[model samples]
Target: MKKAVTILFVLVFMCGGFMQAQVVKSISLNSGMVWSTQKFDYKDINYDLPNEYLTGFHIGFAVEFLQHEYFSILTEIGYTQKGFKLEVDITTPDFPEGGLGTMEIKYSYKYAYLSPMFKVRKEFRGFIPYVFIGPRLDYLLEYPTDEFSEESAKYFNDFIFGMTYGLGLEYMFGSFGVGLIFQNQYDFTLAYHHELEEGYDSGVDIKNNAFILDLGVKFYFGKE
Candidate 1:
């Protein structure tokens, strides 16, 4: 974990140097809705958990470094929310009659994310179309604690890594612009911490996935 964080920061500094060499094109503030899907792996459990799409939100600021009209580097930092829901039916010894009914569990996490992306853009008659791909480093700020199962809480991780890619369209009006952007992110690492027991050799793997739809405004300085 420590090594991963160290490497991420190193990349950040390297990107910073690259940004300093380029011309700053624009700065933008964005806010919108986020929908997340989570998959859970139960090593020994037999119950089937239903998949759900959970809704959340994100707000952030981005800096664009442009070397040309076709290519640029964008770096953004934001507050984002991601989570999942599970519904399962369980049968235990205590409920010999039939089952303990349906159990519904929801997990929500708040994260601060730093994303550095490479963007490709093209200008149309009155609009700009762009696509971006990047790595997102997220630090967990809040974890679900209220009414959460002990087993679930034990598996949460403090840091997560993901990849984000998206496409958007922008309309510029003088120094200000408004646009819509769609993005999707997938966690490459396990969302939870898993430890092996005395006799077990492996742990379960869980992942989170998210989709974002953003309405953003950009202010271009020294350019009209």
Candidate 2:
């Protein structure tokens, strides 16, 4: 955990080296759809549950540092909603036509994320195509705790380490630009430790993964 946190801070500072490096090129605001889910690694083979992707949203702003015409660094801060929905069907007599009722357990989490990425792009006429990849750090803002006891809920990991990568296309109209970006975040750290009251550690690991599609609007500050 110490190593992970250190690495995240280092990457963040590296990407935010605007003073020592190049000039600021642009600042952009982005927001759109987020599809997220959790993958579980169970220590005991007999225990498992079903999970499905939850459709959510994310909003953020980014600062781009331009070192050259074809390369730059992007530092982003964002808020995103992610989780999963578990549904089960049971036979019931409440319905006259059909005796089936669906019960759902929805787990929702909110996070604030920081991403420092390297971008490679090329401009074709007025169109720009780009690709970016970086390491990301996410802080858990809120999580569903109604399902767990207070002591157990405390096991939730507040910090998450992940990787961010994406491809995007933009149309530049003078100093203003509009773009479509498709990105994915895959976490290397566990979302929760989930060690129940029983002293024996089950080591049930849960990790988060998300797919994002954002419409980015940018305003160029100056040409580098």
CA displacement after TM-score superposition, residue 100 of candidate 1 (Å) = 11
**How does model 2 score by TM-score?**
0.83
For residues 122-167, write the lDDT of model 2, one tens digit per residue: 9999899999999998998888878767867777888999999999
lDDT of each: 0.80, 0.84
Model 1 is weakest, by summed lDDT over 10 consecutive residues, at: 195-204
> Which residue ranges in model 2 land beyond 4 Å of their true spot?
1-22, 46-48, 90-99, 196-203
Off by over 4 Å in 1: 1-22, 46-48, 87-105, 147-154, 196-203
Candidate 1: what lDDT? 0.80
**lDDT score for residue 144 of model 1:** 80
Give the TM-scores of the predictions, in the order they appear. 0.78, 0.83
Clashes of each: 0, 0
User: Whose lDDT is greatest here?
Assistant: 2
Lowest lDDT sum, 10 consecutive residues, model 2, at 90-99
> Can you write out model 1's per-residue Cα lDDT over 1-224, one digit (the tens) per residue?
46545755775676467556656778898999999977777676654457787789899778888757799888887878888877777767877564677876777888877888999999886599999999988877777888547765777777788898999999988888899999998888877866656565455666889999999999875667
Candidate 1 TM-score, true structure as reference: 0.78
